[model samples]
Target chain A: MYPANKYYVKGFVMSSYSERLNEYISMVNNELDRLLPEQRIPQQVVIDAMRYSLLSGGKRIRAVLVLEFCRMCGGDVAAALPIACAVEMLHCYSLIHDDLPCMDDDDLRRGRPSCHIAFGEANALLAGDGLLTLAFETILSSRNLAPEQIVKAAGVLSKAAGYQGMVGGQTVDLQNEGKPISGETLEYIHALKTGALIRAAVQMGCITAKADEGLCSGADEYAEKIGLSFQIIDDILDIVGFAQEMGKPVGSDRNNDKTTFATLYGVDKARQIVKTLNDEAKALLKRFPKANEFIYEFTDSLTSRTC
Target chain B: MYPANKYYVKGFVMSSYSERLNEYISMVNNELDRLLPEQRIPQQVVIDAMRYSLLSGGKRIRAVLVLEFCRMCGGDVAAALPIACAVEMLHCYSLIHDDLPCMDDDDLRRGRPSCHIAFGEANALLAGDGLLTLAFETILSSRNLAPEQIVKAAGVLSKAAGYQGMVGGQTVDLQNEGKPISGETLEYIHALKTGALIRAAVQMGCITAKADEGLCSGADEYAEKIGLSFQIIDDILDIVGFAQEMGKPVGSDRNNDKTTFATLYGVDKARQIVKTLNDEAKALLKRFPKANEFIYEFTDSLTSRTC
Candidate 1:
């Protein structure tokens, strides 16, 4: 499934990065399934809609980041797995809400119909609400983590997903859509809209691992850079990448008349920024002695990926 | 505002139930304002939308339940106040989503335009999401509560608000709309949709108070009965209550073609049931020696209120 890993694994003494990441992704998927299995109740439709969007295959980058960061911080990955899944759930909920007709209004996600298209708008809305609620439930219910850690992690997650974070970012994005916006405004949108959650994933991992302030800040800095680059790559891909690989149709930003890094800075400059951010992100990771070769390769891959 | 309470305040030795309840309501409103003040940022629109719906005055029944139950269980009201605000936030979030054009399609809430009507659909949707996320954040960020208790209370909240609880009930209610449904189905819907959170409010208060299981169970039983009666009263209100007092159009259930206890059982039977349930609910409160006369009056008031 991840055959490209063979070429990237040359310098790594441990198992290939793809293998480990795949294992974490699989763990997340299985845990999600177990946590939100289908039921035969009358309200099963909402659960089905939630699972449909939640289980749809994406890169699972957030989950991988969570587990990898925890592992890098010398934390128990097993205990961190639930937090990883929680971040993914939060991500999916945001995606579902963002695709609604009143928002981005995208009809497709992950190469399939968006949640509202697949499920009616009402159920899709409820599904998103359910997923968001379930994310907190997942964190609070997690075992092997201390109560203080769970509370801290859940608080971090809620703040990242709330008005001060992703929702705020989305609001500003919506307000600025179809209008010319400055590069600073674009960065602000991306920072809260995408960067906050990505940073939260790293922070939650560190919290679960009981990492010190120094280590946590370092991971957060690394995450912030990568988060920006990830969005920049997403912007670039929307303009130039293949629809099949990306799953959703390309040129969506243009269609929505929304500004992006590629649009605001031009594709050439955006590409350069991605490289710079990726390098800076990877450099920050070097501060963690325990962070293995896989983390570096993973960071590098984000800037170069076509999809 | 609560002149009627003067007539009912004769038997209470401490402050009148209305005064106590009003004080709790005021405390909740203040805390919510403090926690989610209007911000002057690009994302301020979303915050405004959130504050719009959140600050809209309702009966504050859930907040009162949290504070009153905590007080009855010998918990510090100040410590429990945050949880009270959290429940109200959760309730408001649900109300916002439920009133969306996609869901209940309500244009009016609390005598004014619904969140979606005032803010555009997109911002309203985000406001609902924001509030829901903030609810958990409020609970997790609550000071003075033990970590274990906070986790337990938050877990209870997330479950009540998630797919298996309020969302599930909403889904089923939506599915059954315009379709003939039995009394059993209505009971199930009311239980999850309204009963779950009401029960959670009581349970959260008990958990915060470190109330024993016996007390929790007794309180839960009281809550469950009132919850059902509360819904039954809502159904009745939709049929016969004054729009000016109810703060929304009457006969919406009939307009939406929704089946309710008032429709399923004739108004007289429904009225009788409310009385029975209210009495039973008040009877359960007798097990709590620490519970004050305010609780008993509060229980009886739900069945008799016009709004």
Candidate 2:
């Protein structure tokens, strides 16, 4: 299950983060296929389109967080699969809608035509809607989780994904697209738009495991630090990364006139912010000695990744 | 509280269905206002648009079904309010998406500008997504319902709304527009699109009430009959009822060149179909004497009214 790339630092080989990520991605991708409707049903096109948008390559960072945090908290990773998959669905839903005609209107996703381009806009719209609904459906129908925890997980995911969360953040992002926006506003936008779900992914894992208060707080703080770092690094990568490396065109933010960390504070400051966030995240992870290894490694790999 | 309008038939003056419907509408609307995010939040625009469409005005027919059915099954209607509100949210989400620019492209809904018209299409789209997510979040958050029942209800609502349900139905409806459609195809479309949620509402009440198997089957039968009847009456009303009465313009079906029962069969035949469906619904309702009274009266109001 190891990815071919091995991280080498100062001559000692690091346990390859790519290998662990790929392993989790394969696991999550399978569950997602099982969770989504297959093509035999009526309106098979919708299911096909839904699968198309979801199965296309993404790093599966949220899924890994759910699993790794569950492992950290002594929860069954198998039982946490549904919650892990649900976060990915939420992520894909946002991408599908964000690329719509009236929205960012992007033609590419993962170097492929976006859902709206591959399927018609209307179907893409429904596909996004279907995925969001299915996220709950998957959790509600999950085989291993307790009912109370299922409800808790649903609340966490939805609160992060709903109007006051990702949807709300996207609204602000859309409204301020071409217009000048403050760093405070941008922080607010990404916190919900991207960070909210990241935070939820870790929280859902803690809930699934029934982790103690201290561990839960640690996970939350860890998630927030990495969440901010993730977005800042994403902003950095889009400017300098090649299309082949990033799996999509570079400088999309500039093309779309989006204000990111790079635009506001310069790349050096943004990189410095990412480094600071990484240190803070690792410090938070220190609370759980047994579970922090994968997480710390994961965070380190995230900041240093070219894509 | 009894409505002033009395239905005089066979020497009995049945309480006014309008008064009962109005009563439930008021309660549901208040809760809906409470359930949706307030304008003070950062994504105030998304919440504002969501409330504008949901609060504008509709019969709240689906919401009433949940309460009445719960009451009939001897369950607490107050406890059922969350599920009731959830169904309406799902219904509203579909309407918003169905009226989008690439879909039906309708400017009006309930005699006012649709969500896409009032808000821009992108915001309208997000509003629909936000409501759909909120529906699950509301159910998962319901304090009155048991966790097990919440899970069951989520499965029911999502299945009825997802690819095999309303979304699937709408897909067919969109594809078949402007083309000659068979009666079977049309039935398939409406069954998923309209009948699914209508059926889900009744089933939800049954589940909430913890009704026995026979009663659940009876509720299902009752819902199917009424659901079909509702559409037939709607098709019939468009050709004959006043726009003022219906709250939206009439002849929209003909204007859009979409096929319906009235279009495929003669108007007289469509009216007969409504009569037959109403009779069948009443027959199924006979299984529950206490609950059937309001449902029967409600069905009568539905068929005989100009609106």
Model 2 lDDT on a 0 to 1 scale: 0.84
Candidate 1 lDDT tens digits, B1-307: 1233432223246677777777777877877899998778899999999999888888889988987788788877778877888899899999989998888888999999999989999999999899999999988988789999999999999999999899999999999989889999999999999999999999998998899999999999998999999999999988989898778899999997888999999888999999999888888998888777788888878877743
DockQ of every predicted complex: 0.87, 0.74
Report the Cα lDDT for residue A159, model 2: 91
Q: Give one digit per residue, the lDDT tens place, for model 2 in A65-171.
A: 99888878887777888899999998998999998989988888888899989989989988898888888788888888899999889989989998878998899
Find the candidate with the highest DockQ and give its number: 1
Instruction: Give candidate 1's error at residue A116 in angstroms.
Output: 1.1
Q: Where does model 1 exceed 4 Å of error?
A: A1-12, B1-12
Considering chain A alone, report the TM-score of candidate 1 relative to the true chain A: 0.95
Name every residue pair that clashes in candidate 1. Answer: none
**Which runs in model 2 stand beyond 4 Å of their true positions?**
A1-19, B1-16, B305-307
In candidate 1 the C-alpha lDDT for residue B135 amounts to 90
Instruction: Show the lowest summed lDDT stretch of 10 residues, model 2 chain B.
Output: B3-12
